[model samples]
Target: MTFKAAKEFNTPVGNYCYYHISRETYPIGITQIKEGNSVYIMATPEKALCDLIANQPGINLRYKKEALEFLEENLRFDMDKFCQFNPEIFLAYAKNGKKSTSILTILKLLQHE
Candidate 1:
């Protein structure tokens, strides 16, 4: 995923695979997992959710209500697990990623909950 806005493309590999191109440095939470001879680099749950919010088009969450609606109604996210996410990761993403206002709104929503 990328911090900068660019054309989004999908690779046809059974399930569609989308990739983001980055032009600047940004904070990301990732983990490397190894199984036998294979290693996989994956984004943490916090980072994945942040990336989804930041990268998705037409998402302009500027208030707690909007953020909450998107999370609960649109995404059907489990509110029980919402509070478990690391706030610091969202803060870091908000600092260096796109859609700062939306990201901050999410942070604020989390805090209020």
Candidate 2:
């Protein structure tokens, strides 16, 4: 299997919904929302990411299901375009060692891309 020494996905267990990525050599796991965006990562350098979204004092807004679909369709792993903006995530995967480590987004695992 190409995913023999695969990576692990670090996401919230339930109510907490921030899918954070940290330093860990996992066999296989899911990090990003297997469905949407509005990634709710923790501001700290921790492995656990959760979505802490709430209405502001005056503004009342929420990430709708459609918005998530939009993100997945348009922004999901469009690294060719999005990397210019935030390159760290991509860099992390690139800097990964060839034999020692491998990073594959859940999408790739789906299509075996």
Candidate 3:
């Protein structure tokens, strides 16, 4: 699937637009599928993989330092506590190298020079 985001909706966190739907009490990551019309998977990891592996088809929410910090501060050791609660996504992230992936991307967005 193509990773497409609304150009008009960039967030203060940068890059990935905030997935706000109003009804959602807690803000969770969301990808707007124009074709599938699915809200996509929540920010959790396990369901993200399940959605993709099971062929649910959703874009991954890109995050860097701020996101990691948020996850670390709020989530800590338990991976499932994040929103919809998926663990495999974290595993996939670790396998793919989170340091180089979103972490680098995060620094670039926040750099002030």
Candidate 4:
């Protein structure tokens, strides 16, 4: 997955592009998968969420309730799958990435779930 600016553009194939800036914002917990003759590398869901929070401007998830609302209402993130996310990834990202408050709140939300 790509992490650059928070702008999205429609591709010819109708897929939306989401990206971010800065090397520090690059995702963690990446994995590579091979299918047939092709290989693809992508970030884990935890890292992707962190990257989204850090790079997407105008988002304000300062409190746990706000973070939860953002996840449930704005992103419609599946709470059932929330249990599978690695809290360590969010912790690591909060230590060195932008949006520390929002990231930490997300981690706190995970812990209480």
Which candidate number maximizes TM-score? 4
| Root mean square deviation (Cα) for candidate 4 | 2.7
Per-residue lDDT of 1-113 in model 3, one digit per residue for the tens? 22333234456776543322222222222334444655544444432332232222232325554544644563463533444343334334433432323433322333321
List clashing residue pairs in candidate 2. Answer: 9-29, 9-30, 17-51, 18-49, 18-50, 18-51
- Tell me the whole-model lDDT of each prediction, alpha carbons only: 0.79, 0.28, 0.36, 0.81
- Of 1 and 3, the candidate ahead on TM-score is 1
lDDT measured at residue 57 in model 1 versus the true structure, 0 to 100: 89
The digit string of per-residue lDDT tens for model 4 on 1-113 reads 35445666777888676665456556466778899999988888898888888878898687889988999999999999986799999988888788888899999999994
Task: Itemize residue pairs with steric clashes in candidate 3.
Answer: 45-86, 46-86, 46-87
Residue 81, model 3: lDDT of 45
The candidate that achieves the highest lDDT relative to the unseen native structure: 4
> Per-prediction RMSD in angstroms?
3.0, 16.0, 13.9, 2.7
Regions of candidate 2 where Cα sits further than 4 Å from its true position: 1-84, 97-113
How far is 13's C-alpha from truth in model 2 (Å)?
Answer: 9.9
Q: Considering summed lDDT, which 10 consecutive residues are worst modelled in model 2?
A: 46-55
